[model samples]
Target chain A: MSDLSRLSLNQATIKYAGMEQAVSACLRAEIPGIGLWREPVAEYGLRKTGALLRQAGLTPTSMCRGGFFTSPDSDQRIKDLADNRAAVDECAELGVPELVLVSGGLPDGSRDVDGARSMVLDSLAELAPYAGERGVRLAIEPLHPMFCSDRCVVATLGQALDLASRFPAEQVGVVVDTYHIWWDPTVYQAIERAEGRISAFQVCDWITPLPAGVLLGRGMMGDGCIELRRMREAVDKAGYTGPIEVEIFNQEIWDADAMEIAELTAARYVEHVL
Target chain B: MSDLSRLSLNQATIKYAGMEQAVSACLRAEIPGIGLWREPVAEYGLRKTGALLRQAGLTPTSMCRGGFFTSPDSDQRIKDLADNRAAVDECAELGVPELVLVSGGLPDGSRDVDGARSMVLDSLAELAPYAGERGVRLAIEPLHPMFCSDRCVVATLGQALDLASRFPAEQVGVVVDTYHIWWDPTVYQAIERAEGRISAFQVCDWITPLPAGVLLGRGMMGDGCIELRRMREAVDKAGYTGPIEVEIFNQEIWDADAMEIAELTAARYVEHVL
Candidate 1:
């Protein structure tokens, strides 16, 4: 069996699981960390969820997300920034150091990607310090280009780092997700460049024949063609000694039994990623 | 009416139409150029297809594709190389100057992307000379990262150029497809770097909620969020004054009447791309 010491469950991997079941599974499997999402945490009551995790001695690795900073509408931008700030507060409350930020896609009906990216930076300017003061690092997650139009405008790890460079390293950093960035030609160098700014190292394999909307296409570690172990080594070499979170968003895996999913993920983490 | 001077109808846009219908639509619209795919041209008799385009006073802009050069099997690699040579011969036969190369995905069940990319360069080294001798430039088309797994491994214009840079510019160049490269953060600079090495400029807008396969997700020019005119200008500024090929691969467009698709593409080309 692989070492589960650094393995963190992103919770999205077994997407339908309740907090109670997720923590129970982690505790049973000796998985030391669990990354929580905002919606489910709110549903379970944040204080109670924190109590359960603290009681179980499970480290809350990172929060789900807190960035949609690309809308053209002024009101929408204000609301998104506020939501991001609230997300940072939540991360601080949970004792999670990193809050994942999915920079939103282009403004509706706008074709200016560069402009949208600029807006991402502008929003970061406003939110980074606030997050830093809360002891929460804003981790910019670069979703694959397939989601560039609908989900995150940050399409490359390099771009994410470029955005993060403007703010303090502790306040702003990049997420090195294998699923989103495995296809990048400059990935190794970008990972090396990430160095101290690497906030969270998320793992998921990229399987082909992406589903409609192309949202839930992530694979279990060994099921796809990603060089998971190689990337893990690279991220580790770049000074990232944090929890390695498995964050597959595939539908079939989500539909499977939660405990089974966690078990298989742990096994695969040992076989393919470790 | 939009200037049909440089507009080229890539036959795949009206995917079901025969050679005669495609040529007729282009002729009727006064579109001066056409891009042909190998399958349909082979079906129609290569010489006869050439004669038909010549008779219709149409220019054959580019040969659809010729690069699946990423198999570990020696026999498969030999067959693929021979096929690429045949594609070059077809391009020369139809008097087309450029043959689009879609550097294939990873070897079956392989996670070595770097190794797959190296294989692409090795194949290009063999094919470029043969293509150049026949007066055809191998146009390295960097397909979108979404296709990096199944369809094409060259996932960025910069990567394509890096591969192309090793060969003589006349023998090896790159294709700038709006649908593929528009999401790239450094795209504009990459276009400028392409300079005289740009062999073809293909236009197709990117739309979201991509279909299951993600292959037919290309949108007609103005129907999506891509800034086509800006890219068109950049390509022109990069010294590419060649045929502007409209190559939409949407199944819905393919199902529509051929003539209507051509007309709408022409209108959109004028409005959004010209």
Candidate 2:
């Protein structure tokens, strides 16, 4: 069995729950770590939520997101950078070490994925130092390639590492989400390559018959084909001793009671991801 | 602009059409080639279909498809291999040089993606010589990573090439479908690496909000975001001057009039994919 101390409940897994409920769910499940989303933190007042988590003895594992820098418009690019900077500030305030980023997709009517990827590098270059100075790592998360067109241009851990290679390990890192990277053939090698630069080790399952939009199709642990334990071991072997955040986004998962889902996630994590 | 002489209508784009309708639509659109599917060819008698294509002066660009070699059961693997051999024979009989192979996904209840991938190599080792002797190249088509679980495990041009590298070039090669590979960060490098071993160059567009059961979610050319022209040029530069087959699988396209889709595909070929 795995240690419950390392499992973090990412708030998006029970997206229906607000700060207090999410905290309660995590507490009930005995999941020692909790990943916060900027929206919930903002809604609950960042300082208040941070205070509550600290009082409850919960480690804020990471922050949900802070990157969508693929817009071609200079104004949009400026705004996106500012938003990332704000996210960095939020992570720092919440005592979250990792600020996970989902790099934005191609510009409207644009087919230049290469160009979009370069924009991510530029975004990273600008944000990494700021994040590092604030004791936060800008964690680039590569979403599944299915989301490459409309969601994230970073489609592989190798690509994420490539982007992070330019920055110090303290400044920039990559999010290793099993749901996204499990399908990659070079995944193990990439995981090994990401040793020092792994910011967040997120867990989720990948199931088929992906729903429309494909964003909320992540399966719960043991509910899909991914060898979750194998991936967990790979990440662990790669020298990441941080929290393993359960970050599922399925509609079915979200529709369930938050406490029930969190407890179930904890149980499944032990069964499938240990 | 691309040469009309090199354009091939892969029948799946207008999947509603039977062999006769596909041929008629190809004729109406002045397309010089057609990619045949095994199901339709079996429905229309192999010899008769081959004779009809020859009479219509249309080249059989490729045959779709032949490879589900990921089954773990020894008996099932044997069955799959026998079926693939039969597919190669069908392709040979139909005068199609490229037998497009979608190496099957993880076996039911199997999470061994690495083991499943090795099975592909073993399958290739068994099938390549047989295909080479029969004047057919087993063209491994690495599907988009989205299909990596249940449709095709070979999910990148690089992986396909790795499987093909062991076999003689005359026996094994790969299909470079723009829709499947366009999102890859190393796509251009992989394409260049696949120079002499590129057996098929299929074209299609990729749009967002992927329909449930994404098998039929491919977009019509010029309808979605794919750098079709650039990919085509890359293939040409890589020394592949073979028939550029337009293979789309979309419910919307399937529901459309076959001849209209054919004509539109031709127009889109000129405007978007040339």
Compose the digit string of candidate 2's lDDT tens values, residues B90-141: 9988879999998999999888888999999999999999999999999999
- Which consecutive 10 residues in model 1 chain A have the weakest lDDT in total? A23-32
What is the two-chain DockQ of model 1? 0.85
TM-scores for all predictions: 0.99, 0.98
Tell me the spans in candidate 2 whose CA falls farther than 4 Å from its real position.
Answer: none
Candidate models: Cα lDDT each: 0.91, 0.92
lDDT of 2 at A140: 93
Spell out the clash pairs found in candidate 1: none
TM-score of chain B for predicted candidate 2: 0.98
Q: Can you tell me the CAPRI class of model 1?
A: high
Fraction of true contacts retained by every candidate, in order, equals: 0.78, 0.74
